[model samples]
Target: MLVRTAYRLETGLREAASRVALRIGWTAAVLPYPGYGTQGRARVLGRVLLAPTATDPAARRGVPGWQRLLTLERPGVDVVVELGGSRRTVRSDEGGIVDATLDVRMPEGRATATLTVGERYDTATVHVAPDDARLGVVCDIDDTAWVTNLHDPLRAVWRTLARSSGGRRAVPGMAGLLQALRGRYPDAPVVYLSNGPWNLAGPVARFLEHSGFPAGPLLMTDWGITPRAWFRDGQAHKRSSLERLVEDFPQVSWVLIGDDGEHDPDLYGEFAARHPDRVAAIALRQVVPRPRERAVADDPPPDSDHDGSTAARAPSGTLVVRAPDGTGLLRGLRDALGVEPDRAGDDDVGW
Candidate 1:
């Protein structure tokens, strides 16, 4: 009863604020996110927000990450999405997120979709993976791809607030590792699945591109109060996103990459156990010493058998590799995938 009351109060406050913003001449704008799709269907992802009039220069310069979090959302707004020669009107959710799956056919490779809200418009890049593609990649963002220091909450918050996306450092060798995977499987799609809020999508996407990581789509969750809960469940978000990927791309076997600072090992283990055939391999970057507290039964203990140089098959028959950085994981991944090292360019490859 208390939860329901709090949700109602929150909804009421948001509605009141929306009305005031509209009365003061705030206009609706569209923020598009890169989405992934198969050959036959495409998922359009975006957000609708209430922003200052067209005269504001910040609209053109792009808002910073912290400012983005403070912006007002215009929920239930109508956004027209045009892709593959088809036009559809989709409604944003209560959180102003437009997540619509349309049955539009497009050839394999990168495609563009236009999203329009009133006079404001943005193009969302959609990656269409070939149906015959055998391999796909799902990577975590926080510690696996970039150095966010998630284990240290205070430092993580400070860095996120102080640093621009370009200023943030990418995990050494990770970009090269992802690029190598792309080189091997040219048609494979790379999906970044993170527990971070959607407000940081722009920054995260920028970081990935500027750091030379192969781009695909970002699947991030919304933060703050929900109708049913007060705070978002990060672990549940990751788990559900993983399951949805299995449903979205049934034929593609995924190479899951994440760090062991949190619940990644346990979560990936459970996923591999449930869908053994869907997973090709699991690569875990040892961001920090394995936590002393065992949060779950499936969490793998500290690596004592090898010095982050070998790939071992897990109990579920999936190959698992652990490394401190991408270079070590690259070696283990090559071994697991049975690919020869590109010795000619190995020395120059910096992630």
Candidate 2:
């Protein structure tokens, strides 16, 4: 009885200290969405945080450091964002997110937006796929880009918390495939959509850069409970993002890429079905399900059984790739977009 009482006291003290630390460490943070639109009226989206210091030890390993058990939304804070010569001010929502539009005259190329909250400033870039560009690529991060064992939640979290960009391993040849896609369509845009928590954005961005992948905008999400749901739906996040992208760029045809480990197949399939004309191709990575996956699963048969035969039903041009280290994706894209040899002499290589 005495030991139990002591443990309770210790736990209470730790909670109290954590609360105090959060209160003291709160600061302004801006999470900017990669804004894309036409020159006349481009839209900008971002979140403003009276952000508390992230205390999770996993942060050092590569998970988002700005995320915490408690979210302190600073509603009504005024934010200023600038692009080229145009500047605009908007207030954060009750959730501390800012979704605003700005008028700017940007010449063809990647454009940068500078967001400022008092002296704290951060920059985010947006891609403007050329008017005549034929294809766009929407990519998934987990099993599609690299292997993070989503089937085993604990193992996934440990890998994220223990690895740095250099320490982390990207799927071999994945970068080459993306780079080659850019080579095929010089002006095409590649957007990364991940259900991974936004706190790990820094590491993910670094990993992409180090791997020589083409540059584009990242759309990530927060990983805590919200008012309507007990837990966040990652599929829901990807769904909305895809909807927004399709709506925003009506003229651009998209090639979807993801792994079979999660809901990418279903989500991409559904998305392609709805917007058949806009979707050019859908590529899914074939992942071997682990023992834990079998023990905990009911629906969605394992990869070997599913075999992506069902994906063909999702869209007219859908196919599953083995993701044989990246060759599978390369082959899929080759069939979909007509893979071309990358020329180092040409300027198409870099962002």
Candidate 3:
């Protein structure tokens, strides 16, 4: 069960979100939706839905019905009912709200796709098709994307409080790689899922946009939760957040990128194993990529199959390409995705 705790957003940030909420859906998880990015209205940064775009019929769009946007990260998920079926069906009005389902599948030949939206967990399976396509680029910020010198995370934390965070330099050529991904797949989305908190958005965006990093969707945790709080601490359902992203974008394959310092490799490994095909490639960012960690990403610990991390779905094709600098990870995306394209629709590209 989702225990909604009262999180204390920094007064200043809370005020900003309240003002923006009138224009956008500025809740913590995915905010600024439906307004404000562009003055009176923010660009529809992105919307989460169970169905794919019907405009692209060949693109494997989900049947139009009442489906809410569920998790889109490590265990990518979504739900839809196929009534026409060999299926099941539901009806909705134009603005993306579902009133009710018209009918249930009574015929024996009909197989309704009533994929239920269930409890938020480490891994939840949802409808996914192989032929479908979308943009795919995984991004990371911090010492890798920028020279925040997060080798000492505390210093980075202080820099944010001081609001001098933007003063830090950008990693060499990192922006070029992001630009490259943007240039290559304009329609595909690039997500920055960082350990950074909500307060860093303004400064971080300024630094990234100023230095040339493509400014797109960003995912950050709130600092409001105390570490002792089981879910909120540093371990809030980040994997769940990651799952939400992947599940939301059906076409986009995974181009995982991150540093070795924290659990990026481990997290990405678990994600890759579950949806190997979704993960086109992974570039672990680092100054000197350690051999041991690389080994872990490439070949997770033997007990991974039995471990909670890997217990989600059997691991997938998590190719951990070592990036000398943050730029290297970006460069590797072009290299790996180009040479060996995603399995097209092969969901099971296992270890």
**Candidate number with greatest lDDT:** 1
- lDDT of each candidate versus the true structure: 0.82, 0.65, 0.45
lDDT by residue (144-191, candidate 3, tens digit) is 677655556776655445444345677766677667666666544566
TM-scores, in order shown? 0.90, 0.75, 0.54
The per-residue C-alpha lDDT of model 2 at residue 147 equals 74
Could you give the candidate ranking by lDDT, starting with the highest?
1, 2, 3
Worst 10 residues of 1 by lDDT: 291-300
Candidate 2 whole-model C-alpha lDDT, 0 to 1: 0.65
Measure candidate 1: CA RMSD: 3.0
> 1-351, model 1: which lDDT tens digit per residue?
777788899879878988898899988888889998895889989998887776431233344456657767788889999998988999998888998788888999889999898988888999999988889999999998999899999888876766668678999889988998998889989999998888888888888998999999999998877667888889999999999989889899999998889888889878988998998899888888653232222335434334454456666888877778888788777756768756566444422
* Evaluation by lDDT, superior candidate among 1 and 2: 1
Best to worst by TM-score, what's the order? 1, 2, 3
In candidate 2, which residue ranges exceed 4 Å CA deviation?
1-34, 37-45, 51-73, 289-322, 339-351
* Best of the candidates, TM-score: 1
